[model samples]
Target chain A: MTWDILNIIGTIAFAISGAFIAREVNYDLLGGYVLGFTTAFGGGLVRNLLIEIPIELIWSQDYLFGIAFLGITIAFFMPDNWIGHLKKWVIFFDAIGLAAFAIQGADYAVSIQAPLIAVIVAAVMTGAGGGLIRDVFAGRKPMIFHSEIYALWAAFAGFMIGLDLMRGPYATLFLLIVIVIFRMISVHFKWNLPHKK
Target chain B: MTWDILNIIGTIAFAISGAFIAREVNYDLLGGYVLGFTTAFGGGLVRNLLIEIPIELIWSQDYLFGIAFLGITIAFFMPDNWIGHLKKWVIFFDAIGLAAFAIQGADYAVSIQAPLIAVIVAAVMTGAGGGLIRDVFAGRKPMIFHSEIYALWAAFAGFMIGLDLMRGPYATLFLLIVIVIFRMISVHFKWNLPHKK
Candidate 1:
């Protein structure tokens, strides 16, 4: 997928999840919006600060307002089953976002001559940062703590993007797609790492 | 008026506000602690970042566990009406905190040889940043935008502290006291800039 399309999907998916969680927690409209915006873009903000992106647009209100609209609109029409039946859908889209954004972040950081480690870190952050933040805002332990595969998936995507070993944009796109599918399958099947759960 | 005393007060006041505001919003125990810690120490996080301070403390279980205790203890024992009645008292101490931290911020920046304007901005932020973040986390426009003369009052104190002429510590402390009293009076009398409303 083109990066633009992927980004918009990622952003909207994030916004929706934040809205859904806010509803579960009974946040007010503005609070729901705040949660949405932070969930959608907090990773980007963290990346910018760490990677030296300008802070102006990040701090501005465009993305914030967009997420607020999404949250309120969702709340206005949501059914009781939306929360329970939608868990898998949220996770699937979330994995897609993680892969795409991780590649994007690694590319941007590497383009700026960031160290390899920094590239990996920034990539994983751009991918998983929003989810981590949403959990924090919702007062829940982050999925990253419970799910090891999520970060590792982002790292794999980031590694390919940063190393520039991929042949073309299609190759990079395929790498991201593989990571996304791999993560979804891993999560669905209850894959575990060496550490204790 | 010593910096240490002011620092302690600012931390405690912001922490209390965090706890109180979360309770007002009907947050659970963990949520209350999260809000309080974010309000009390978030500005210091930004301040440290601006000056390249490490951010490890924000995530330490020790800090988290401590803040949780601090908040839950207040929530457990304090009567619901207690904080509401102590609103004025909280504001008074908070103003002192603002003045103290603002000065501390400017002094630190100046010591690090940041530009004058940068130092000035840092001072203003250190004064109000915690409250601003608290507002964001709590889903409201920050109280600084309300009829409080708090930020400017802190700036005035910071100016005196970072004064190039080098006054005695006692003089700086006296200025902080003056700003605190002035701020309390302003808030009590509904004093505000005429054009703002």
Candidate 2:
């Protein structure tokens, strides 16, 4: 299914992003893999718990684990000089992963007949939980908490889904594109949430 | 029956430790409550998910939530001078909570007939997960990962329980006391894990 493809892509993208961050933070190779794996799967783990799904089911997804491992391995072996070039694309990939996971997370919550608030929370947590854990492991505040137009986009997607405004493959695809575009625009403009100075 | 009492004591102790950390880190009133609640309940949440327990069951424990909230509020209102004195006792309380949760967590895994590794993981995670999350939310490295004799005590309890070397109410109580004493001795001796400089 198209959803499965998107999920795989998101997993790989997030895994790579997590590995890159790990390297940037000077983590050892094992640390990089741990962070990468957590980034790719932590959200789903959280969503599964929230929806009362058996988390053992995640371990059955061999491809998910394989892809994350591959992504981290590749990131670890890449040339040092190429790191800067790759960094530019990390955000784009991260955004795609975020959008894909956000919609998918909402879908899971909806399937479970969770409340509206729970649906929105599932969306944001699924999209961002791995990254948040990654940052935590790296001893930094999660960037999404302070970043411009990050978690909000996921919340918006969840809102629309919970409101019954979006459904089906086409709607999901459309929303995904919109989220990616909006995230890029916000980043480009350096838009930020209000903070206490 | 005794386990329930120990559980309540552990929850209150962990919640207070969380609130104390939040105060030390200068979090707002709401942040203190959030951190306190997470520290008290996050371990159980992790344990439940891992053991395939329904997470909603946690909501049924109204008194647990009440205790955590009360602990945070009290910590928030403490006079500034008293804060330093309270910090000295936080570790002692934290060690008690750790032992209580570790035994409980291992017991849950044993009840479920989980593998030995899973039993050990459940024990350590249930004992340490909350504190790790507390540090993460406070934007610091988790102390257990870096500290000597912290996670080890939980692991020891788990190992003994899993190996059937310890059992029953009296055995659990004995292990708890031993863990606390060992932790305090390590702290007094300034024992720490070797780290790469």
Pairs of colliding residues, candidate 1: none
Candidates, DockQ: 0.06, 0.15
lDDT of 1 at A165: 71
B125 Cα displacement, candidate 1 (Å): 10
Model 2 regions lying over 4 Å from their true place: A27-34, A49-59, A73-79, A193-197, B1-45, B54-124, B127-131, B137-139, B144-197
Instruction: List pairs with backbone clashes in candidate 2.
Output: none
Docking class of 2: incorrect
Question: Native-contact fraction for each model?
Answer: 0.00, 0.20
lDDT of 2: 0.82
Query: Given the true complex, what DockQ would model 2 score?
Result: 0.15
User: Worst lDDT window (10 residues) for model 2 chain A?
Assistant: A25-34
lDDT of 1 by residue, B1-197 (tens): 35656776777777788878777777777767777777677776776665554567545536444644675467435986776787777888788778777877777777776655446556766777777677667775455643346667766655665566436687767777887889888888877642200
